[model samples]
Target: MNAEIDFAPLLPLEWLAVLAAISAAAVVLSLVLRSPGWALRGLAALALLTALGNPSLTQELRDPLPDVAIVVIDESASNAIDGRDAQTEAAETELAAALDALARDPDAPMEVRTVRVDRRSESVEDADQGTRLLTALEGAAAEIAPDRIAGAILVTDGQAHDPEVFSNFPAPVHVLLTGREGEWDRRLALQTAPAFGIVGEEVDVAFRVEALGDAPEEATRFARVEVRLDGEIHTVVDAPVGRTATLPIPIEHGGSNVVSLSVAMREGELTDRNNAAVFSVNGVRDRLRVLLVSGEPHPGERTWRNLLKADPSVDLVHFTILRPPTKQDGVPVFELSLISFPTRELFMQKIDEFDLIIFDRYRRRGVLPNAYIENVARYVRDGGAILIASGPAFAGVESLYRTPLRSVLPGRPTARIFEQGYRPEVTELGERHPVTAGLVHENAVQAAPSAEDADPGEGPTWGRWFRQIELEATSGQTVMSGASAAPLLILDRVGEGRVASLASDHAWLWSRGFEGGGPQAELLRRLAHWLMKEPELEEEALTAEVAGAEVTVTRRSVETTPGRLTAASPSGETLEAEFVEVGPGRWQATIRAEEPGLWTLTDGVLEGVAAVGPPAPKEFENPVSTGAVLAALADASNGGVMRLADGMPDLRRVRPGRTAAGRGWIGMARQEAYSVRDITLTPLAPGWLMLLLAAGLALGAWRIEGR
Candidate 1:
């Protein structure tokens, strides 16, 4: 038992200083006056003041609290390589017996918590085991108090990428690593590739082969990589690595192309699971078919012409209506300088032939009747693309907004024109969006400016358009907003067709070097391609690219957030992975899916995308034959490193607080407790008797002092 005195003061130490001064003054007065009564009075006052300071005795008792032990087991991909599986089972059984014996002990004070760290096999890439350890610790710590934690025991090979996270742990961490020593191997790494490339074009893919631990110095490993197009091997190549190898694989069709690359693990290699990977690439059309119509020639007419003509692959059919359909000019049809507009031949006869139709500064003229306008709407609904670059005429009574095409256009023209020169900026959503991503003010520096006052040095910064259609955006994604969040550029789908409405026709001036041109060509290209259902423009797609035996897989989504990529082998094992962004709106990762077969890749939330291959080479088929490669992790940590040949130990139990051990089992004994109490009290005075005694003592002292 322990006890201590604690004082509770009514006043602060500063008041105590005042009391000391008063006592000193009384002493000085008594000495100067030669009064013995003054001395006695001062002594009594000091005793009374001291008694008023409250004090009490405190006692404390301690009892043993439960100690918690956390056991973490690694079940990642590398842990399952060889005989490590059996080793893991044996360790678990021994540990379980130790825990059971401790729980049964009458003096044990420890509790055991078990955690398993498994590989994210349902993904596309290798999962790091160390990350899982940190996660498990975080979870366990949250559930249990830090003060009660005794220590942590990890059963792993220690192939963790993040060991630094363990440094801040409050308890000692012990590793019982499981793996054999002398494990060495090789792996295929996909170096690089473009996420999106034009069909029929040769895209360069770079890759390499890495030899891990004691691989032969001068050994040559032959890697056979096959490029598959829609489940068929389009091309195959054999390459020797250690040096960077670039393979120019042609994209045959436009869409998601799944490519698998496989490398044969050398004979007698440790493990073969890392011998292959898969990559995906989005294929895009090489050219676009555009049909442009103008009711009357304007400055924007030349803009569309120049833009389309700039690309050699673009097929442009431009038609201008020099005269209105209602005009009764005296000039003969043969003498007219312009040919009749082929409205029927184009819209009614073969509207599906064109990928995109752009109507620039056009009105509802008699050239196209109500029936033909309805036909155009039907064409857009049937997987065609349309763009309406509206001008001032769109606000008039004859505006197409009043025609059958009005139902498909994004906004209704309010005829309000805001002429202030404002910097053209992409909306917040457009920053990461595929259509206008990376096309902000910085991209404008390269565009041709349309204003005379614009300085050549200034270039065409992101500047505002002159007019806006003060119309509500009822449907689709509003990519560009003007003053007060006014919809400027709207993209929406109408019956399988993509439609875009640009509120201002002056956008052409930005393309013509008026204020220094912006990224007009790029913006137009993305818009046109996106409307044509190009795979690269898809909001979400799973694609793969192969160069030799190294493949880089990619998953593209309209959602800016990144999602996990899961690749499944025919054996039903899945690998969860993540892709990095190599360019705007593109996420990719290089993995060697070397075994080949119909390897399936997915984000799990989306559809399962597949890559087909004949069994890569029979050499790396056995993924679990090597025991040496499986034990490297056991040697790194201060754990007993042994092999299956060494023989497994029996389980045992030990005392909890003392670390006592038994046979093959380790146990923590349970603690027991009982309680006891005692109480006592004492009185300073016995009622009236103490008062009478105090009076008699006072009288005796006074009489004696008087003499």
Candidate 2:
């Protein structure tokens, strides 16, 4: 307990000033009138004033409070280096013990508040600062006022994200580094990478390799780097250290493409975690080439051309066989405005140049010989796509199914052609296939309408078709069905390529608003892209998207149910993801994500990658425990930075105006904080005593003035 004396006014200052003025005037009048009682008059006024003022002695009982010394512990990702974490633990233990001992002393007491900050896989706000200790320090300072703050001590690997946030801190900031003095690490760094690039085009990527700390210059001057994209290793070269090297990397496909560069681990390296770096670059297509072949002019022929032509990314090559040579009577080719068919060029020479080749009601013609037909088959089996829109001609003797191409065809016509109006519906398999699933019948009057009739507004059914050639599924999945529920759309894989068969060419009637005008354009567009092997349209696939702290996982398959999937974090922890069917061939679920980095997903067999959080976050950019990031902050605060690996320094307390650090000891500025618990005011004299003294003085002055 402590004691103090203080004064509080009994009356308002304005009233007290008036009383003083009256007393001074009375004394002056006695002196000017040559009265011998001038001193007596002054004495009476003093007594009266003393009684009115009521001055009292107040005693305050105060309880001393210890000064708070905050110790912010750095547990960020960089502290995971070889011996940094262990070293930090030891230093924390020692610092706590010293502060506790100081608190036990009677002359100088201190309070310790230790704040432990866990590692950050990545932080967006800390992206530019490189470390996150300052935010935590500012928070601690706000909790304890500056008057009682002994000083702030940061125990870290020396890398701070926001050292500039120290302006708000009233106390000095000291750094206690946690790594060895001579440790070395070799790291691969990405100098520059475009966030988006055109698929199949060479993109310029720059990178560097360098030795950190005091490692031998020769050892790092030349390092071997392994470059990979989408998990496939491709580039390996010995790159010179401390310099940027520009190389060409082809963007392989559309959507997210991840590129990772890693350097082989060297002996005695501090840590291999920072030896590699990864980044994501989105892939985009430049253009798509499509070849359209129409056996004869049909209503739907223009529909197909219009869909492809509307897309700016699609380059359409359309041809119409106006008159088959077999149907030609006496017409001369030169006299007519028709040009010779380019079968040899499109089918044999430049076949691979086209992304997709569509055949509408195409049948064997004398113009395209048996060899040319065989070339088309080979093309489909060699990474090319083919779509067959079967008509009554498919049931004829000259059907393309009777040629060598039959082996690649997914179905064969059965000579049973339904010529009645029938609404189209998706098969069970189509509900899970990317191409046919999720397709809405925009114009059809019903959802599950009758094949014979469609009402004004009911089930999902496309506009009625006049004809549907019956076909038997040979190999491949049937996605759509028509009249009597027979296969209307069939998809198959032939070697490395894909093939699709549509049973009718009357789909163009939907575009004419027949019934309601169906989703003919949408269906054909997706079907074409699927045949071209778009990754998102694959029969079996897993994908993930990230938004803030939530990660959405999607799985697509032809199976009846989408089972549980497992997501792996960069830290090697696996979490089960539950998915709900959002559409045919699509299942999605969102999960809480705490760690930021590359996230991998799998259904036991196939695996995919997605990055969560900021791009190339500064926290994980470098994992070495270096003092460079925090050196400036320590200097400006007049604090010393010392490595704990050498030895733990002593903790001391000093006066407020003195320096708070020394060669072997760190000191905290004394705040001299206290709280007043009780106060008592004592009157120096009785009120009656003052009244008697004033009367005696006034009488003496009256008598002296009369004499």
Candidate 3:
């Protein structure tokens, strides 16, 4: 309870002041003239003024509120290293007991609030922002009023990624570090990783093995690092620690090329997770070098040229034998076409330079000898790609099957030609193949094949072709069929190369919008990419995708049933997972990934790697516990820093603006915050009492004046 004096004037203040001034002047004049009863007149005036000024005694009943103290605990991955978690829990328990003790204090009580910063408690949105200790502290303090916040205490490894610094805190902030002194850590850090690199070229990835804290001199001298390309060990390199080493990784094919680097784990280091880092660089072709050789001038020849030329990235070298050596032409040599075909330079000298070779209606026309055709077959075996777009000539005496190229050719000509119009259909195997899967929907055409010459059953959804060569698929898988299910498109792998056979010249009919054009552009693009050995277009593949903490493994294969997949986590724990068929040939299985590192997936044949969280989690970047990260914050709040290894410090209540921390002790501010529960006002001067006193003084003045 508290008491104070207050006033409520009965008359206006201006009128009361005027009456007091007149009475004071009259009393002074009487004193100056030596008149009697001057003192009594002054007393009478003072009494009258006191009656108008209503004075009261105000009393307030207040309830003392407890000062709030927030404790922010760091439960991030970094805090889990080297017994820091145990230290944190101990500190939390000790601090809670201390706060409870302060709550029993009669002078200044405390309300303890705890906020834990952890990845498990995070939503998918802020999961990437690791170890936000200060952010959590600020959020916890926001709920408490500024005056009621006695102070905040943080128990962590001091690896906060949040850039927030509190310049003005309501009270002191103390930091209790969890780890011991002289702890060391070794980490693999990626300095420079290009987002893209040209296929077939080497991209220099810069990285370094760093020694943090008090790492031993011998441990920092040299480090053995393993370089992994696409999840497989590519090479082992001996790199000097603390210096940037550039590793040249060759881009073998187009699409995503993942490069993972790992330094050998030290026995006593902070963690092995940060010793490995993984990043992906997309492999792109500088220019697709394609050699398009046409045996004769045909209407469909322009279709191939237009498609290849439309892409600005393709470097097309087209050659047509308008007048072969056998043709007796009467035209002069100077009157012929400007440039001569460099057959020897292309086939013998620079054949390996081209990424893809296309033979459009090409037959044995004596322009290319048997040796050149054999060289072409050898090129396919040496990681080259070939597309054979055969016409009716494929079934004639001059067929390419008769040449040395037949060794790599996926199909053999049957010496039969179908002249009737037929709609091309994706085979049952092609429905699962990446190249032809969902091609029907992408064509965006619902019209049936040409009704006049269509097959008796429900025709294909695309347009019709007038002619197709009948071929027996001796090797490879048939992806498309025509004319009563004869092999129309066959794809195969020869050595390290790829071969594709499209047995129809009437593909141009679809390009010309014949009978509602099919997916000519889309189909040809996919076909070319497949022939060039694009990773996404592989017939058999193992792949994994990550969404938050779940890893979805997808297996695409041409086999009837894809077997189970064995997943090896970053910790080398293998798990056998069965697959469920989601699509035609695609099977998938999802696993919860609690770890944040590379996950290796394989089915004994194909292998793949997927990253669950960041390849190198930010939490483990600086796993060595220290007080430097929170030093500024503590100093700004006039607090102190101490290691839990030393001992749990005694908690004390200190006055604001004084020393809040000292040797062996930390302090919380003494906030006298309170709320008023009840108020009472007792009138000190009543109107009747003041009137009676004034009348008695006036009578005394009259008696003195009469005497």
Instruction: Highest lDDT: give the candidate number.
Output: 3
Alpha-carbon deviation at 14 in model 1, angstroms: 99
Question: Who is ahead in TM-score, 1 or 3?
Answer: 3
lDDT per residue as tens, model 1, 1-707: 44556655456767866876887787687678876565455555554445444445655454556667778876765666566667777877877776666555555456789988776521233221223555676678678766666555666655544444544454444455566655556666667867798876878888776666556654446566665555556777776756668878777667766566666656756666566655666787777789999878888889778878887878899998777867887878767655677889998998888889998888877889898888889899887889888777777877888999988887877766665655555676665667887666445334433445434344336545666556567777777776656777888899889898877677775676555556767887788777777766666667766453355677666555567777776567676677888765678866666434456676665544554332232222222223233233323321222333344433233232443222232222222332224322222333344445545544554564598
Error of 3 at 495 (Å): 1.0
Q: Would you give me the overall lDDT of model 3?
A: 0.86
Note the Cα lDDT for every prediction shown.
0.64, 0.79, 0.86
| Clash pairs detected, candidate 3 | none
- TM for every model, in the order presented, reads 0.48, 0.85, 0.88
Question: Tens-digit lDDT track for model 2 on 310-385?
Answer: 9999999999887777776787877654677798998889988998899888887776888888888998888889
Top-TM-score candidate index? 3
Tens-place lDDT per residue, model 3, 206-266, is 9988899999899998999998888888999999999999999999878778788898787
99: Cα error in model 2, Å:
2.0
Two-way lDDT contest, 1 vs 2, winner: 2
What is the lDDT ranking, best to worst?
Answer: 3, 2, 1
Worst ten in a row by lDDT for model 1: 121-130
